[model samples]
Each structure stands twice: as C-alpha cells, then as structure tokens.
Target: MNKSKWLYFWGLLITVAIIVISCHHLPPSKSSVTIKLSGWGGSPVEQKLLKQVLQDFEVKHPNIKVKYEVISDQYMDVIKTRLIGEAAPDVFYLDALEAPFLMSQNVLEPLDNYITPEFDLADFEENLLNSFKYQKHIYGLPKDYSTLALFYNKKAFSKAGLDSPPNTWNELRSYSQQLTGKLNKYGFGESPELARQAYKIKAYGGKIVDKKGNATFASESGLKGLNLVIDQYQKERTSVLKSDVGASSGSDMFGQGKVSMVIEGNWAIPYLQETFPQIDFATAEVPTINNKKGTMVYTVAYVMNKQTKHKQAAWKLISYLTGKEGMEKWTGKGFALPTRKSVAEKLGYDQDNFRSALVAGVDYATPWQVGKYPAAIANNFDNQFISALLGEQPLNQAMLRAENNANQQIKMME
Candidate 1:
C-alpha cells in the first residue's frame, strides 16, 4: 500500500480503538445526574439533619444525586460570579431580599413548569409565597421560615411580679418600665438595627415601609415605635445590647439574665439550649402593635439558576425540598418554622407553645423585605437607628436622616 494510505488506515484503527475504550470506561453514561444544591453555611446540628434529608432524597430518587455546597460568606458575590460564568449550581438558597434582584434578572428558573398539584404550592403560606413570586410567577420555594418572638426570663418576671407576657404595645412599655433595674440589668430590649421587624413597632398598626418602599418612620406610628426604643436609653440605662448580656445575641441577653426580656428569633433556641442550659425562660408572640399582633418574618427559598444545564432536575429538587414531606423533614427539628402549613402540623411544630407563636405570626408579621435596595436602606437605617438608640440623635431627627438616605437611594435607583 502507498505510505499515505497506510497512515490513514492506522489512524482509523486508532480512532475506533479510542472510541471503544472510552465507552467501556465511562460510568454508565448516567441518565441519573447529580445536581448541586447551594446554601449558606450551617451549624453541625443543621448539617446532620440536612445530610440525612439529602440521603433520603437520593434513596427515593435513585436516578438523581444532590451535591450540597455551603457558601459561607459574601453569598451574593460567589453566586453572582458562578451565575455570570454559567457555572452556578443547579439549585441555590436565595434570600427574600435578593430574590427580587435575581428574579428581575430572569436568572431564576420559574418552578411553575415543574410544580404539580401534588407539590401543593397552596400548602405554603401565602405571604411568604408572595415574597418568592416575581411578576406573577413563583421563582423559588421556601423550605423553612423564622419569626420574631418575645423571650423573657421567668425569674426576672417573678421578680417583677408579672404573671403573663405583654399582649400589646402599651403593656410592653409598662412592663419594660417595671422591669428596669436600679443598675445595668435592664427591663427589656430588642435588636434596634432591624427597623422593619414587624414585632418592633408601636401598637398602632405601624409599618416599616410602604408598598412603594418609602420609609414610614416619619409617620406617627413610626415615631411611636422609635420613641419606645429611644426611651430604652433615656428613660433608663437598664436595657442592654444583646452583646452586653454575655451572650452572642439579643436573645442571649435574656438567656444569661443580662436583661429581663428581649425579642428575638427561633435561632436563639438552639443557642440557649447548647450555651446556657440553665436559664428559665418563656416565649410568646411579640406584643401587638396598634392592638394587632406583629412579628418580623424572615424567609429564604431554593432558587434555580436560569443558566443551569439541568433545569428539569433542578426543579425536581426544589419541588421535593418544599413539598409537604420535604418541608416536614426540613423544619421538623423545631429549628425553624415550616413555610408550608401542612408540614407545620405534621411535624408537631404547632404543638410547642413557644414555637407555635411563629405559626400565628405567619399571618400578621411583615415580610423582611426592605425593597430592591436592601443594602443601602439597611445600612442607612441601621446606622441612624443605632445612633437614635444610643441617644446621639433625637428620634425624629435620626429617623428623618435615615428616611432621607433611603429615599435618596431609591431616587438614584429611579
């Protein structure tokens, strides 16, 4: 044979050999794919349960595997990077605050196509569901939620001779005054930096922001809430920051007996149980503002990247995680409230007195959304509000400054 023909024949033989060897070694060219599920870092406790749940899912859906990726910090930075590079996970945890931005970008896969009647989107709380929806299509699904609760030391209450938790804003004020110590041990306190916290208002139907994202602090109701917080420093020096309480959090103050009472979230439950095991405490719904119950509701949801290669598989995981049985397992540990109503009952979450208050709060509490420009609004509000809390700025002036900053940001967005 001619030299050229001989070389071509050898090349053809080598190509066929490579194709056969590659096929033989490849792992069964899996129709079953492993999807990546990204979320913020969690404690060991959370990891144990989550790993178990993921394993359970793998067992049931033998064709799919979930790769858990915990993003520890600068969550958006990493997520944005992956998304821009089209290397984002199949599914990721999206905060309600950031969901609007992601949804607006058309980067999230709308679960609508994957949602079946069996998925039961109706089973989830409407308000929380509203937070995940963008332009009338649901973009994410919440596996769990958290709500603010009034936590008070029973020993402190006994000292103050209070028999029951305060039910209204006036009662809260009265209780705070009565509980104030002659020294550093204060009567009551809360995280002042979180202004839109539904539980942090006067009992007068006060709101943090209007539908248009305008600051409501200048309103009479807003002033009342600010005044109540302002009085904590001026009226008495008893109220302490959660940091001062020898605890890492506001709820820690109540747990360590630094303050008689404080409003915080369910996250404090495990912290107190693990850190300060001896504290006697009771939990109740936050005091009613404006004769109506109130509490801050915080929620996060599983969002799919628009750039994902496995849209269908990504959605199966989302549906499974937020579905009734999935939600039950996700929130079954009392670590958080289930976003779905049925799972709340199935997991006996409604039976726990303290935890159950969060169930009621789901109906009345405000969404933790501070609008599209959360960072700007939160930073300005927190800075000015802290100044107000420390008595550096008068309540009205501080609020005005915060309002101006936030409005200026919004106008700039416009």
Candidate 2:
C-alpha cells in the first residue's frame, strides 16, 4: 500500500533466498553403514580391550557402525552353519588350522585388491601371512600368534639346585628327575595332545600330512621323536600328564606345585600371574629336541565374507584390526603375541622376560596345522597317543593304528 512497506517486504524475501542458496552448497552429511563382526568369547580383560579398540575405530569412522557378536561355544561349527545359511558376519576370525579347509571352499573374499602400499603388508611375518594364502590368493590376515616356551617354577628350580632351564631334551629329563620328589610330584608336565607333540614329530624330519592331505606321521623318523616321549613317561617316570595328577592343564599342573616345568604359550603368563599369584615362574625357549630347536606355533586371522554387501566397510574393520596401530593395542597387554614384525618390535615382546623365549621359538616353530582334514588327523593322533601313554598298547602299534585310522577318515572325506 505504501513505498516504505513494499521495500521492507522485498528485502526480507531476498534475504530468505540467499540463505537457501548457501545451504545447498554446503557438504552433504555422510550416510552411515553398519557391518557385523563375530569372534569367540575371550577373557573379560581381553573383551574390554577389544571393545575399546572397536570404539576407537567407530570414532575415526563416523559413517560406519559395528555390530559385534561372541560365539562362546562350538565356535567353528556354528560359524560353518551360519556361513552355509548366509547368516554369517561380514568379518570373523579364522584359525590357521581351519584355514585350509575354509579357503578351499571358496567362501572367503580375497583381500589383495583392497590392500594398498600404505597398509605395509610386508611387515607381517612370512610364516603367519602364508598360512592364510591359498592357490596364490590371500584370504585372511593374521591378527595374533603364539609359540610354545618352557615354563619353569623358580622356587622349585632353586630347591633342586638348578640354576637355569634345560638346554637339551636329555638335560630336561635329568632336571625332571632331580626336581621330582624334591619340591614337586613330577619334574615335568606334558600335554599329550598332538598340537603339543607335532614339533617333536618334526624334529626327526617327519611329515604329518602328505601333499594329498593324507596322514603320514607314523614313519620311522616320526616314531623316533615319539619314543623320546614314551621313554620319559614309562622308563624314566619323571614326567606326568595333567590327567595323571588330577589337574586341568599343564599350566595348572605346574601352578599347583605338582610339576616343576611345563611347555606353554604367552597366554599362560597372564593366567599364571592372576590365578596363582604366589608361584614365581620364568620362561625359556623350549629345550632342543634331537640337538635342534623346535616348538609349536598357533595363529588366527581376520577373514572377509565373499557375499558381503558392504565390502569397503568390512575391509576397513579388517585393515584397522590387523594394521600396526590396532595390533599394538591388541597385543599391548601380552595376552597374545603380534603377528606383524613391526608391532612385535614396537611392543618389545622379544625383550619381555616372560615372552622373550616364545618370540625366539617362532623362527623354528611348527605351525599347529595338520592339513585340510585336521580333525581326522588330530583326533586319531590324540586318542592313540593317550592309549600308549597309559600303557594300553605299545607306542609303535598305537601310532600305526592312529595313522591308518586317520588316513581312512581322510579318504572317506575325499
């Protein structure tokens, strides 16, 4: 109606238009993507540490969300069932022992294309990295690993007047004899499982599995190494199994003052320290077997699902977890050793008093993987080995029976 009122209305309309135009040029907000990850349950502390690391990842990746699940029982069985049903997590843990079978099944996503130069793939230990490779393609990246080491009770050693750990198998037997009936029930505790004895078999140049995935660890050379175990259990009677002493494991046998020495991994450090705080213990590289160093190494990796809809998000989680920064945090508490060489160096596990011996053995250790048919081989070997230990049958006869049974089972699968 009036000139001044008309001018005010026009100015307000121009101001509103300018504000709308500026808003359109601003950066669009990132769309969020959530991925599921699954792993077996661990100790409370380990779980807390992993949760913290995952939280850190979420903070750095504001657009991504992680849904984590812990399969506490029958982990591999449940994982396999979930995989076939197409309900498996986008990323999950794969142990080296089961990698061969799973990698052959064409269920896993190859990680080579997503890996970049900045990821420093070369920093991983060759043995660990190789475990997840099949037919020239990398299927998984190892998160952590452990190797067997001699765990000795320091007070028991002092009572037996021994100054240091045994350097050879013969010395170990002798030390076992001296330590027995003095400060403990037995001088050495043995874990009769094949996972613990596979290194012994290898020390005599024995092969556990043929290229065809058949069991072949019953040869003369394999028998020779196994005889070392038999002699100590029957003739020397200086070593005993956990079952014989009514203990749960080699660590428990040693912790309960029933044995002076046991072979275990880095996991035993925290367990022993917390569960049996009064017992003082020390670790050393396993005694040389047949004049050569030998031990068993176990490792697990993070693998991707081929059917995943969110490949980039899954890769980000895997890369961050197996990457240097994430690995340092995971292995910082020393529950497990880092699989990456750089992370191991940064954590100084090689220099740690309790873990140094374990780190030294990795160079010569036999990975705890039999073949694609690991269950058949391991189950038969463990059963027969125990029968022989209990004097139910001769060692040679027991091993031959185990070898035949394992091969038969493998043939059935093939």
Candidate 3:
C-alpha cells in the first residue's frame, strides 16, 4: 500500500515539473513574448513615467513583455545604422518628415497588413495617418501630433489695449504695430522658418511640391506666402527675427516676454507651464491669410523595421502604441496631442476650454509634407531664410536663389 501511494504522488510531481520546464515553448496565446520598444530617451521624469506605463502595459498583457530601449539622443543616426545592419529595434519612433524616406527604402513593414477589421483605424486623424502611407498602403499609425499655434501673451495684449487675438492678416499687422515698443519687445515673431512654412504654403493653396514630388511651390503663390513672412520683418518692422532678438529661438522670446506672440507647437506646454508660470499666455490658430484659414501639422509614428525577425511581436507593439487605449494612456500626461480623433475627443482636446482655437485647427490643417530630397529644400533654405529675416537680403531675390540651389541639389541627388 505504501509503495503504490508513494509512486503515484512521485509520478504526478514529475509531470507538473516537466510542464513548468517546457513553459517557454508554449504557443503565443499562452506564452510570454518579449519585444524591444525604443524611442527618444528623455529626462528623469519622463523616464520614470514611461517605465510606469510600460509596467502597466505588461500588467495588461501578461503574455507580452516590453523591453524599453532608449534610442540615443542622435536617434536617426543610430536607428539608420541599426536598420543597415538588420538589427533594428522591433518598435521605434519615426518622424512624419522621415516616413516618406523610410517607407520608400523598404525599411518599414506596411502596417495595413497587420491591422485588423476590429481595430477601428478610422478613429485616427486622416492627415496624420496619411503621412505614414506610401503607395496607398499605410506603413505606420500615428501615436501623437502637434500643430503650429500662435501663442500670445495676455499681458502684452492688455498693455496694447488689444481687444482680442487677431483673426485676419490685416488685424495681425495692425496689432503687431501697436504692440511693438521702444524696448525692442516686439509685437510678433518672425517664425515662418523653413521648418514651419507649411502653414503659409497651405494658407494660399500653394503646393510645396506637385503629385510627382517636385518643388512646385516656389511660384507666384509660394512667393506670396514666403514674402508675407519676410514682409512682416522687412517691410512692416513690427516683428523681429529670432536671431535679431537675444532669444535665439522664437519660443524663447515668447517665454521671456521679449515678443508678444510666437508660433509654437504643443511640446512647449510643459516647458512654459513649469518655467514661465507667471506668463499669462494662451494659444490660438495662426492668423488667417488670403481669406483662407490653415495651420501646420507634424506627427510621430511607431514603425517596425522591415528587417525585424520578430515581425509578429513588432506588429503587436506598433498596433498597441497606436491603438486607441495605448495612445490615450501615452498622451494622457498632456505632453502631446493625440493623433486619433477619438483619443483627442476623449482628452477633451477637440473642444478644450483653454486651447480650443488651436484644437479647432485640426480639420483644415495641412501636414508639413515636403519631398524626400534628403531635406534639401529645408536645409538649403533654412539659414538663408533666417538671413533674409535678418534683413541681410531682399526677400524675393533670396527665395529665388534658394529655389534654384535646392532644385540643383535635388537634381544631383536624383
């Protein structure tokens, strides 16, 4: 009796031990899967917050484990080299500006294939979602986005006795003049830099490039958009270039109260809130021009490297981050605006009380889309454009030269 009972208990224990030892071989439905998630590493606060979020994600998906990797400060350089070596992270950050290049290089897996019918992909902002698309196939889904908004100082407005924020270009000019003072605390900022020219370009229906990706916007309407900015500093003299002001950056001037208003993005919120809490400021849509209302949009997407061996796990991480729940949690800290219309609505960003005007701009806003000529147009025009803003060259002539040189560089690259 004792031998048989002891043998039965031993057999049961050995069977359970074997199952535990073979746990790693279990199917994905029952197995724990580890995936690499990488993005721009940040300050201590951000690191802590992100780690907690990752922990929460692990809690929700007990079978899925996230390995958070801080893709260095030189994010693109490191990411591109990893892609070249076929050792890129399963999930990584891809800027909207870089989406066209990465997608065309066969470096990103098309996300449309992984997306399921039940995912509610339509909840995303069309422009942001479209930015990650190539050949009519979406490569990535946007996690968040930011638009250029005019941030105005209330104290400056009160000092000038202005009734409200400018809605029309004419009012902007007049308001700029009235707010400029002898102390060089100018009314406005010269912020239509090459990095943020999309607003002006779209305001006048000027195409930066045609369907075939050519620099077509260096035309009459484009010139008007370009000149409209230069004229503010060159002719009206009501606004000051960032270089002319001691700030060296437009947002800095607004923060320091050196300028009454400046065009900036949502990332500035935390900085402004923490550093310059005393500044009574609010955000509005960029002043309307040419009888058309418009704003500039930029987005960040979660992309998978085409070379990733763990394609299934990679897709799962990407889909999770861009998914409604994940985006709502990731952007819940108010560090960014959600790219999904549903998430934005959930965040109350669609009709937010404080920054409603800026949120109202998502409908008509145009993405900051330029051709993938290695950012030739942007790089070539950046310094020269800033120089033009400094009154170092005639606006028309400087832009013409920029257009010629950029096209030449593009031709050589082709």
Best by TM-score: 2
Q: How much lDDT does each candidate structure score?
A: 0.78, 0.93, 0.78
The worst-scoring run of ten residues by lDDT in candidate 3 lies at 350-359
Model 2, 1-414: lDDT tens digits are 699999999999999999999999989998899989999989999999999999999998989999999999999999899899998899999999999999999999999999999999999988888899999999999999999999999999999899999999999999999998988989999898999999999998998998988888899999888998899999999999988999999889988999999999988999999999999999999999889899999999999999899999999999999999999998898888998888898888889899989988888889888889899999999999999988999988999999999999988898
Report how far off residue 282 is in candidate 2 (Å): 0.5
Q: Which one is best on lDDT? A: 2
RMSD of each: 7.0, 1.6, 3.4
Sort by TM-score, best first: 2, 3, 1
Which stretches of candidate 3 lie above 4 Å from their native place? Answer: 1-31, 182-184
Q: After best superposition, candidate 2 residue 31: deviation in angstroms?
A: 1.4
Candidate 3 similarity to native, TM-score: 0.90
Residue 279 displacement (Å), model 2: 0.9
How close to the true structure is residue 1 of candidate 1, measured as C-alpha lDDT? Answer: 100
Question: TM-scores for all candidates?
Answer: 0.88, 0.96, 0.90
Better of 1 and 2 by lDDT: 2
